[model samples]
Target: MPRIELKTKIRAKKEIVFDLARSIDLHKISTEHTDEQAVDGKTSGLIGAGEWVTWRAKHLGVYQNLTSRITEFKRPDFFADEMVKGAFKHFRHEHHFAEVDGKTLMTDFFDYTSPFGLLGVLADRLFLKNYMKGLLVKRNDTIKEFAESERWKEVLSS
Candidate 1:
């Protein structure tokens, strides 16, 4: 199993940051490689626990479909989502938020295992690990930008 954990502070209210953190729309905007469409559930508006969204996107130029379910949620604080169906052998990600000096401290924790057993482990070491990290870095950088941008103000009000 591989675990990736990342934390960063965003200058915004916890609720605002947390909401944007889970927004599929924001995700599509942030991840340049992902073209996501919400299906089988609320595509827009607020998302909460028990909601499920299906998305199709291009990852590494390969189109993939994934369905994720919100397994746990506490508004403005934390949420957890697990891949119901996807490419990976196992994938579960948790998002956490906290307030600090009027800023939001956001954390992402992901756990996954590769499909090919020892071969998968070796493959991860050779490419997937760094690739995944770079992917996450890109995602977080976009998140930081969005959280600090004027657009997020509109997010705050809504």
Candidate 2:
């Protein structure tokens, strides 16, 4: 499995960053370039523990569907989601939030085992890892944009 960890500093409260991280609506906005959509399950609002979401998106010139469920959650702190059904053999994404000097320190630990064994490993080493990291970076940038401004109210207060 390949693990990609990312830490992003946001000039906002942990509560705001946490909620934005779980916001299905904000996700769509961040991934508009990929035309990502919540096709089933919790399609909107903040996703809580045990809630699953099916996402449809175009990536690398291919359209795919992936469903993931939140296995663990702690408000304004941490949460973990695992793949229920997806292209990958298995995957787990953990979101962590901490307060630092009155700001929020958000971190993502994304671990996944791609299918096709050796081919997958090669893919990760060649380009897939960077592709996934880019996606996460885009999403985090979106969350930071919203959390640091009044824009977050639109997504969280819906």
Worst 10 residues of 2 by lDDT: 98-107
Displacement of residue 148 (Cα, Å) in model 1 is 1.6
Off by over 4 Å in 1: 154-158
lDDT of 1 by residue, 7-119 (tens): 88988778778878777667667664666667567576566799888777777679888788899998878999988888889888898998878888989898888788899
Error of 2 at 27 (Å): 0.5
Q: Each prediction's TM-score against the native?
A: 0.88, 0.99
Cα miss at 102, model 2 (Å)? 1.3
Q: List the residue pairs that clash in candidate 1.
A: none
- Candidate 2 local lDDT, 22-130, one digit each (tens): 9999999999999999999999999999999999999999999999999999997999999999899999999999998988999999999999999999999999999
Pairs of residues clashing in candidate 2 = none
